[model samples]
Target chain A: MPDAGSRTASIGLEGGRAVTARPTAGAPRSVRATAARIAGDWLPAVPLLILAVLLLVLPTAVVVLQSFRGETGGITLANWAETLSRKSDRRAIATSLELGALVGTISLLIGAPLAWAISRALPAARTAWLSLLNVGANFGGIGLAFAYTAVLGTYGMVTLALQRLGLPFTPPPSTSFTGLAMAYFYTNIPLFILLTLPAMHTVRDDWMEAAEVCSATRFQFWRHVGIPILTPFLLAGWVLIFTWTVGIYGLAYALAGSAPAAPVRLMTLQIGIALNQSANGQQRAAVMAAILLIIATVSLVTYRIILRRATRWFS
Target chain B: MVFVGRLGRGALFAALAIYLLLPLSAVLLSSFATTWTANPLPDGYTLASWGEALANPRLQAAVARTFGLAAAVLVLDILLVVPAVYWQRVRNPRIRVVTELCAAIPFVLPFIVIAFGILKLTGFAIPSLLGTPPLLLLGHAAIAFPFLYWSVDGAMAAANVVKLNEAAQMCGATPLQTLRHIIVPNIGPGLATGGMLVFATSFGEFALVQVLVGARFENVSLYSLDLLTRTSADFGTLAVLTVLTFIVLFVISTGVVWSNRGKRGTAVAGARAMTAEKDA
Candidate 1:
């Protein structure tokens, strides 16, 4: 919580009054004051700010600028045109969105119930389980992709077990667009669980008890009370997952190799591969535009919706 | 009566346990299977494959490089994140928004954007990122920043930071002294948790290292990837590494979470005791 006095002090100091008030014309008061302020705040960020801007900001600006230009220094929409011209490119974008949506939905389905169970479970076990869930959720991408490949690969034990049970196990064709989506969903379960856990905790037990005392059916309670309160949070979590998967290149690259792995392939994997080719600069630019456009739309829409709902908390 | 509840709970735990453990078990089994090339199940169990992997210098180098990068990023994340978050807590809405926008840049933007941005700016003018420890650290830090920032911010939000700072200030402590003596000690658990997450991320990261750092410096994940792709697969080494990583991450996460819970418990107890004292 903001301290009342600190708030007052910070507020009072605004417009140069709080910081440097001519220092009574004393020797080194201005310098000491400035040094004190800098030491208090800016010192910690100096190295990080320098590194982040150099390592992150500069390259991003260059890519965006380069994407809008031709090799001959002409600005053109030709790259955008080229990216859209290909059926494969369109399909790639479609697959990525589909994967993100499916993963978000399924993970939510699995995660929400699990989160509820954990919240109600014994405290120590709950803590232990949540920690495990955290690790699992964060453990995916490249490392987990390979682990899945080993488990579900052509000679994977799951397939072996299914075969022994007289069930036809076709090894689930690991190289297709569909397979990649399935892998993403499988790995994403823990992530959704972890993200949604915080929201579940925020729903205090007393609120649930109140609903239960009123004889609210599980579905009715969830619908009328839980859903309204938790909807913004769920949406926020979903959007976060979607944004993450949209930019995910590791799983796409590792699992599907060089194949056009659908929508994700177009935006991330294909972009990387396209960049490697000398003649596909325009195509790469077009793909980048499309990817950025998708990200901007999703993020902006989610931000607006969440921001509106978020104001209720402030009020 | 408790028997039924215990049994029911046990069954529930078993199901969840199986779901989580099965994949890991499968991987570990394959890691030791000698004839993975010939049979669906490992034809023979042996440590030979693991020995070979460990013997290779590349794997060792990569593991070293990965840890080194993780350490660097931990420092960087704290340095950038603390001030930015503190200012976010202190500044006007507009300044807060701008700083938050800066902090959130990595989350919204993909890795390629970040990587490409870095590369284009520093292309050959400075040394290449290829095999450079700092460059690898930067890539990992970019990915790890959002996690560190969010977790630390959550902890800061929960703590009564301004009150503590003001109390210290009233006690005649300088700003630096207050932050060092009061703030840092209280927020220790958060910093530790964030650091652990950053460590785990960099240690396990495969993509950035492979793309930017390459095989020149191999972390365990990259090494595992290479082993998987080898014509003669080495499951034993992969097994050992997986088990070790799982154990290390489990310990770090549990430790951080436990410490945070302990601090929270103390805070609650202290508050309650103070209330009681006032009543008396």
Candidate 2:
């Protein structure tokens, strides 16, 4: 990774040395050349910089700032204190972490094998599966909640069919935590498959064959070679899923209404019912939002670190 | 061992098929089911729910609004993302990592948190812009930027945009003329793919619309959620809306894939040529 200045200078030397080397008769051409060089360096970065500052950085700053504001407008930690002290707020945080971990684990359990299979499948089959997974990965939010209800709700098609078949237990209503987890599985499993398939493909046949030549059994080869190589990718995938589930609000909200998930509780407290009723509702919402942001940032940083490690292995 | 391997593969395929299709089929069935009380199959099927959903004035309004917002977001995405990506790739490749991290912030952070933050920031920063469509548009554009930028960047890289620009300039084409005649045409597939992705995402986006302007604006997803939450909620109608959304997203994604397929050979050829030129 050469710096932009060096790369541009090299290209300029190769392509425009004659023009650059010529002695300028006046200051205007030199000034123009200097101006062109500056524009060439900085102009492209301006739009992305502006977008980052205005959209991402400023809003995040506002959340962090507002989380510290007290009722009377003075800067204080009272909002964070009051918000965190509540039993329900603590419960929301605990529940969210639990759900994220559970979703990450379960989806990976299913997704890894699926990614492995897809990676080993014939090319046409692989393409078909990948395309389906791509479409399915985006099947989330309110629409997904509705789909799950149609499958798992009290009068759901699957639920009713299971009852007709004399199954011992009924599927839980879509409003339950169990039901929300089930709905999330639909999105998470496909997402994991999509995310991990490329990594799975990176485990070349030649490596396994080399292991076999070394008198390693299939299971031994996988344990010694495959799993070690895939560990970083797997860990990164899980972290991504964890962060995704932690920040997810729509699927849980649509499924459970105001009932089940911590994300819903935070939202209700922030913008929904609590905002109108409580005087310091906005501050509390900011606090909760800040907490969610911190969780996401930590998970993302972990994911990036894992990805960097994974790149070292693959590269 | 061979028999076991075949069985394992077959089972994997079967499980994936069921896992992916079962929920979707249930929704599709319920949309047409006259009664699906206690059987594996629907008692009978009808298009009444589809007709009802289509006829509903609110659904119509929502469809119009969703498309309008999606279109606005797509335009914004193109205007901002194309230049930014072009700049990063051609002029300042060193900033690539930073641009990527910034673009990825939306994907990492939940839409709810982003919406909430924007809502709070706008209240004090641009009081007049709060709760307006433009505010929502800005949020959607930010959310959609990463997809657009990556797609366009890939195309620009494959096309070897710097060499193309140099060639056009040597041929006496002005910068603007070179961009219009050479670069845009070459990256048509990337532009279309990015536009379609932005449109699909914006059309189906729920959290931003629900959080920022839920009181005033009703998009398809928000409206569907409203229908789903009511005590006397019509499952059939909800199913219809879900199917409609799926159909729209499916078509747009298919278009993207189809365009990519058509251009794959050329993109590969161009990439090889670029590498060859670099080697020379």
Candidate 3:
């Protein structure tokens, strides 16, 4: 109570009341401060909070509700059952995972080394490279797709260059799923580099120096020290890239010929097709279920990982 | 020791740099080429693409509309969110936890799902909020709120709100007066950075606009998409437009990064002043 009144009196004093305050006066000022703090902090969160929850909950609920209902009124799991049994739907799921995994792996292989090189370079060089990588990293989806089309499309320069070089210029499979994966991997490399740059700072020259002094081989040093220290960052970055690649539609949409050919047509694309085809309720329900499943799984996993990691600082 | 490895490192970094810059360079090249059929190199060079893209009246109008919508969304979001976040920060931990979780949903939920929900719920309403520019702005603001919230919240967290408020009260300033006189000026950098970020994102966004508004109102990105897909492929015009977009994004992103860094530096000094004033 005394603490509270002192805070209140302090408010009174600062507001130019020009009066000396007792311990009792601080209590009300503290209460008012607490009130003001709450008002300021929580108010801005409302719109986002409301929108996020609705977005997370609503479509999903609708999906689940619709997926079960028959053409008439009987509640059944037939839609979900059908989603799995249907060859096209099954292929869609497989394609999404395969493309995501491929992209994630390739990007990691290329990006990690680049990140290491940049981190170990001179400060000026590192800053310039990092800035370039930042732009490239963000230049994904539509922008990258467009660029690749110009550079590697049927009439792309790369295709032409290969022809002039007297090499077998087979258009580099630009329209295929493989080409799409390559594009995704290219974009992911910059992002991977950016994510791991912060963690790479943890690897100091002194540590490398000690390793060299000890006469450890380069591979040995990486295996024993570098990998272990960077495991958390690597895992975190990989998971993000993996999930992002899974949900990507733009790159695949732009490059792939159609719903069937695209290697990574997502549930959302399926929903789009259904909506366009006038499948109506079933399409909505299907989208709801797939998105709900995705959101729930991702949120749960990310939350658990982040929570465990966060507690390490305190421990 | 680092000097010994400098040559190898420089070569490596240079390769990485080429990878990042090449695609952009290619786009620029294709745009300027007067005759760049499926040839390995351009046959000639000209400024026709730039003229072609700019000459179209619709494309010009869409660019203007996009800028207007971005500005409006930036202002509307800041005005609405500041009050909400400011109040939440003052409240108890329980309230803060719930609110923070809510704000994070938009980021986690993909644009596809959000578009579906918006279209479903607001389908019949006209000016057809989902299909109109204003509707797009509203959807954008909803999606953009979290970025602004975090930026401002981080700024406020750096600032000592409790002390600032109490000090203002002691100086005979009311709640409204304290917010305007003390808090707003101090957090101006955060506000500006957040606004710039929102503008950059909304300006560049393609998915939401494509789905929500369809072709009812086209932004630059959409226009580019249409140009690529339709008619004779005009590589030159796209290249010019892309270069223009890249420059705009670079400038906006630079402003946000610079302002946020400046705000971070000022936060400590601002905190000290608030504490000093409180003690006095």
Candidate 4:
């Protein structure tokens, strides 16, 4: 093929005695070659580098800086101190963390089996399920809050049905912490399925068959091999979802109006009801945003580590 | 044992179906219902709510603006990411790690936090740009960048873009021509899928839009939030609007899945590129 011919020719030219065709050291041609090499290496990366600095790095720096600045314009730890000391702020942080953990765990438990089933199903069924999951995964934010309300709110369809059936139980209102967690789970379970589906395909059927030939029972094979291989992916998914839930504001804000979560609290303090009600509300919100940034950074680092481990199996 | 296994599988399918369809059916039914309060089924069915939703000028504007903004974001992301990814793949492989980390930043951080940072930064750094559609566009592009980059990167790898580039250049094709004829057509599926996914995501995005531009701009998600928040909020109308949003998303996703149907093998190969990305 023409492709193979060029590749071989280039390799041969590099490998063979071609020193005489090259420019001498310290000559203008060598200088030009060096310049060309440097341009080739870094020029294409410039646009991305600029975008990263402007969009990601600089804003992050601004948050960090604002978190330390007080009303008087000098640097101070007062914002951090007040954020930590305030009972309401501390509770919001705790609630956010607890919600993230709860949602992450629930989604993983529900999604793993579905991912396994989808992977092992017929091709047509797999495609259908995968597409459905993709839709659900993307179906989040305000629309999700509305759907949940229609299903489980005070006058919701299911809630009313249960009321008529004399079940003596009503689901929580769509604004409570528990309700918010349920809504988060609705979207994220599908997200977990989508994220893990690709990873699950890496589990080879031959590996399972080989274990069977070695007298390993299905349970034993799964316990020793399947679970081990799936652990990193599950952990990565958990962390990703956890971070996702932590940063969420629209659903909680839309459903609950004002919930005791870090994101909602930050919004309230920044520009909502809490804004300008206090002298330092803006600074406090900045501090809280910075704290959330820290939590996100930690989650990302853990995700990267788990992804590294997961990629080993993938490769 | 086989019977038990079949029973388990059957139960799993039942759960999956219920989980996927229940909320959707609720939304669909409520949209057409005249009144659905405190009843197992709606008391009456009507298209009045759908008409009311469609008749509202704000809702109409919201739909138009949502598509416009999403389209702009998609174009900007493709333009910015394709070259960076192409260059990284073809010229400087060493910078892959830095670019990947940059792309992953938005995925790791919450949109709320990113919005907060952008809001504060723009307030001081570029006050003129604040509360504009362009700012929101920038935010959407940043958030959607990773998806676009990864999809195109995977497709590029699957297409053996490096070899194709080399061959094209040896045949005296310029870089621009190579990109136009070789790279774009080969990675058409990835570009389409990425574009559609970004469009769907931006259409549904709320936090950034709510924080960055608020009511100055109205997207579908924000419009839905507005309806729900009003004291005299109409559930039927909200339901209709929700269904409309779902239909648009459903259509786009169907296109993506349909385009992906016969190309399953290449899709797997594309996914492997992401795995290789992590290894770097």
Quantify all predictions' global Cα lDDT against the true fold. Answer: 0.61, 0.73, 0.63, 0.74
Per-prediction TM-score:
0.81, 0.87, 0.82, 0.88
| lDDT per residue (tens digit) for residues B1-280 in model 3 | 1222667777877777787787877788877888876577788888888888789687688789778888988987787667665554443224445545545455445555566656655653343455777778877887776677666765665575657766787799876687778887877877877777788768877657776787888887777776665658556676777777777776776666467442212111111111111222
Expressed as tens digits, the lDDT of each residue in B83-175 for candidate 2 is 766655555555566776776678678887777778778888888987788889988888878777767876786787878877887899875
Give the candidate number with the greatest lDDT. Answer: 4
Comparing 2 with 4 on DockQ, the higher-scoring candidate is 4
Per model, how much of the real contact set is kept?
Answer: 0.28, 0.45, 0.25, 0.42
TM-score of chain A of 3: 0.75
Specify the CAPRI tier of model 2.
Answer: acceptable
For residues A1-315, what per-residue lDDT tens digits would candidate 2 score against the true structure? 112223345544443433454456465566778788667655756776676767777888888898998777889998889878977677667777788899999988888877777768887886688667755876788899888878887777778877888886588767656777788888888877766765675577999899888988988877887888787777877888888887777787777655434333433234433432344467777888888888878876776666656655433
Over A97-193, each residue of candidate 1 has an lDDT whose tens digit, in order, gives: 7777777777776666676676567878977676656556544555566567667776677776677678787765556766776677655776666
Candidate number achieving the greatest DockQ relative to the actual structure? 4
Once fitted onto the true fold, the runs of candidate 4 whose alpha carbons sit more than 4 angstroms away are: A1-48, A258-280, B1-4, B262-280
Off by over 4 Å in 2: A1-48, A259-280, B1-4, B93-98, B257-280
Query: Order the candidates by lDDT, highest first — what do you get?
Result: 4, 2, 3, 1
Q: Could you give the C-alpha RMSD of every candidate to the true structure, in order shown?
A: 6.5, 5.0, 7.4, 5.2
lDDT of 4 by residue, A1-315 (tens): 122123334433432332333456566666677897677666766766776767777777887898899798999999999888998788778888888899999888887877777768888778777767756765667778888988888777788888899987679767567788888888888877776776676667999899989999988888899888888877877887888888777777777754444333433224333321344477777887788788988987787667666666543
Candidate 4 docking band: acceptable
Candidate 4 total steric clashes = 0
Pull out the clashing pairs in model 2.
none
Model 3 score (lDDT): 0.63
